[model samples]
Target chain A: MTARIGIVGAGLIGRAWAIVFARAGMTVALYDVDVTALDKAREAIRQSLVDLKQAGLIEDVEAPLALIQTESDLRRAMADVEYIQECGPENIAAKRGIYAELEAVVDSDTVLASSTSGIAASRFTDQLSHPERCLVAHPVNPPYLIPLVEVVPTPSTSETAVNHTMRLMALAQQAPIMVRKEIQGFILNRLQGALLNEALRLFRDGYVSAEDLDKTVKHGLGLRWSFMGPFETIDLNAPSGVVDYGQRYGPLYRDVDRQRGDDDPWDSVTLAALDKERRERLPSQGLADQQAWRDRRLMALMAHQRTVTPS
Target chain B: MTARIGIVGAGLIGRAWAIVFARAGMTVALYDVDVTALDKAREAIRQSLVDLKQAGLIEDVEAPLALIQTESDLRRAMADVEYIQECGPENIAAKRGIYAELEAVVDSDTVLASSTSGIAASRFTDQLSHPERCLVAHPVNPPYLIPLVEVVPTPSTSETAVNHTMRLMALAQQAPIMVRKEIQGFILNRLQGALLNEALRLFRDGYVSAEDLDKTVKHGLGLRWSFMGPFETIDLNAPSGVVDYGQRYGPLYRDVDRQRGDDDPWDSVTLAALDKERRERLPSQGLADQQAWRDRRLMALMAHQRTVTPS
Candidate 1:
């Protein structure tokens, strides 16, 4: 029998998840209470499929489109589903209510995964009868193009559930990393937050401009990071490996960290200034157009990546 | 007459700078005290030019190769040079000595730029006769492949020198970002250190493995960052712009930052363990091969970037 997957929200992330599962040849039931949201999701998914097809990422968009079924009724959409990916609002109340509804319909063996970027599964699933089956499977936006899925398990999350989610993510052609313990913002966001904190501090202190800082990443560090992680990058950087790299530059990094004393709150004033600078470069009205351009650039990069093998 | 450029030291970075200048149609004089190091640099530069040619980055290998001249005498290399890129050892004493000799030989109009990653130009140039012509123009490992050059000026550096260096960098086809003030690690390394500090702490605390952390970056954050910087990324991410993104996620990042209290020292035990983990995946003997592979991947990426227009 074909595996059935239930997506509990027909929003942006929910629709993207639908494409991911449908592309993997799984039956996807995308559910939402709002008929307009469901209608918009269907159109958006169709457009994304066409984009993917044009990027040479998909063989036939129609096949995947045919596999996804959108329904306004939650229970009807989740019927006989082996796994449920909750893509509800980030609010705790909304997540709890949706998970409660999902638990009432899902079978005993169904794995419950939330796509919440920051919230832990325990917060929403503690009162449930089967909290052991719940975990967080956070993904980057537009998961069909970017394949990383951070699988974070709470203390109550069972080992079996984690394994099942990992296997399912791999089957869906996504890169899944296991977070052994639940941490704030998970792995990817924490790393990003770390970099952003420093970037904000630098920009605020007048060390560099926002545009120049972006250039530093896109042209410098980001180039290496695009292919290798920091560990691997440092490992290959020095003569011997990571140990040698640490011996050579670890003190410098330590000094820089020491210099960065106290986690200063991201002030609104600095953010406003940054926003103004960004607007000067790209006005508020041109944001949507820039976003579209960003997506196209991402598509082109993905296409290019597929053609070359990682060293 | 063709513009004459002098490159001090024939080490890895120096040779790369030689290639950068030579490929820009300048007559490059690469200087090193040791004859054997100069000989090695010539062969390495030739090999790199061939690699660049194969990657379709340059039209012809011999054109650039023929433009570079190796010299053992510092005075001979500095003769009639328009700009000098010093790639000597990163030691303060060594830098001070080299600058003294360079000041004695080079013309007053010639700009002196150091390729030092951490040391500020003011530290060594303070004693020189023409401190106004000296500044730090740090580059990534291989300047020919990675185009970013951090054009950092000391307080004493003249506006003419900064403008000349910036124009020179642009002429050489490199991306140069101005550093308004002197700081530890400048921009790129500080940002890198911030991320690595968080990564090390996470690994030490047993939240995630070295391998998984890398995947979270290379596959997730890196995919977007490869083309755009974090600032531009956040700008395009939200509906309005950067301010919208900040309003939505700034608190979450601040919470994460606050939770990361105290800049803990990167312990040796953790680094050893991390190194062990990396060596298990890539043994000590394979480091050189991996580095070569990284370069090839970089070349391929650069070639791909040249073909596409950034949005």
Candidate 2:
């Protein structure tokens, strides 16, 4: 039997979720507070699927399109669904209110997941009638191409909710990693923040240019990261792999972190300096075009990377 | 005048450096401690360039090969070169001995850069008669394709050395980031280690499977990373970008750091479990074949991605 997925919020993310579930042969019910967002979302889904098909990443879009049922009625959308993916506003108050309503309407067997970026489940779900089913299921933008979904569950979240969400993610073909315990920025955001902070620091210090800094990842470190996790990378990097790599350079990383920990590096000077360099590379007027370029490039790389090692 | 590059250490990395410089229209003179290693290095260079040419990542290979010179005399290789990239074994004793030899031969204007992965310049360069010309120019395993070279300069090193090396790297078509001060693991390794340690922790806590953990990156986080550094990603991730993302998740990352501090989850039990899963997905006997497949997949994806946003 096909699993039914109820997505509340017919924005791009919600529609992407719909496409994801529908592509994986699951029934998707997409609902939104406003019908206008729903209409735009529907159009976006069609355009996105066409693009995916052209990229040879999707097939049977017609069926998934047919499986999508759009409705403004929240209760109607929630009925009989095994999983409810809440893509409502990232507002804590909004989430709080929605959880209370969702708890009353959502079946006990159903898993209720939020698309919130960083709000703790324990805080939002605490007031819910069925709080155990609530947690964060943050996906990177354009979920159709980028599959990273950070799954963060609170102590109040039931094991069953987590399992149900995980299975749903699996069936939807989304790659999800549990946050284990709630913390700031989740994993991706934290790691990204740390890197950005350092890169910003370097830029601020006039150690490297913005273009060089960006290329440093795109052409350099990114090549391995696209294929191997950081661990597997170090594991295979040295003659003896990880241990040898650690013995030789662990102290350096430790020191970098230590200096990084210090260095009162966070200041307006750094951000503005970075902003100027970024604007120079991509002015405000051109940022949008550059972003589109980024997306298309990502698609191309994904297609290529899927076929070979990055080197 | 053509930029002359001297590679003193005809090991795999050294030879690869020669190809990188030669392909970029620089005259390359490669020297090795062992004559046999020199011969082996030539064969490796031949095969590697063939692959590069096949990939269309290189041009003028014939000329580059002709420009390639081999010698056991360290002084002769550095005679005409303006920049020297040393890729000797990553041992203090080895570097100390090599530096003394290089110092005696190279003019003060020549920059002596070590390709050592871990040891600081101060560790070995302190003994050099011309230590100002010495610094750590660490590259990821392969510099030709993945162009991230972390340039670390000791306190005693001259700023001119950094500028000269950066200019040479730019000419060589590499993405170089300068560490204002020597730090561990440079940028790439530390970011990698941080991610892997967390991934291990997630697995240890029974949050997810190894395959899923791997997918969480390849299909998820890495897709964005292939183009943008971690910060730029968050900068564009939220409506307001990086700052907004920080406001939302920065505290959480700090909290995670607090809980996860001192937890080296990549310990024995976690390794055993991960190894078990990895073996199941890819048996030990099939490691070689699987690796080949992985390489191919990465190539295809890279090709596709390059044409789009991946490159």
Candidate 1 chain A: worst-modelled 10 consecutive residues by lDDT? A256-265
TM-score of 1: 0.98
| Backbone clash tally (model 2) | 36
The positional error of residue B85 in candidate 2, measured at the CA in angstroms, is 1.5
For candidate 1, lDDT tens digit of each residue in B18-105? 9998889999999999999999999999999999988888999888889999999999888999999999999999999999999899
Best by lDDT: 1
| lDDT, candidates in the order shown | 0.90, 0.72
Poorest stretch of ten by lDDT in candidate 2 chain A: A257-266
Model 2 docking category: acceptable
Question: Pick by TM-score: which candidate is best?
Answer: 1
- Per-residue error at B309 for model 1, in Å? 1.8
TM-score of chain A of each: 0.98, 0.94
Q: What CAPRI class is candidate 1?
A: high
TM-score per candidate: 0.98, 0.85
Q: Clashing pairs in model 1?
A: none
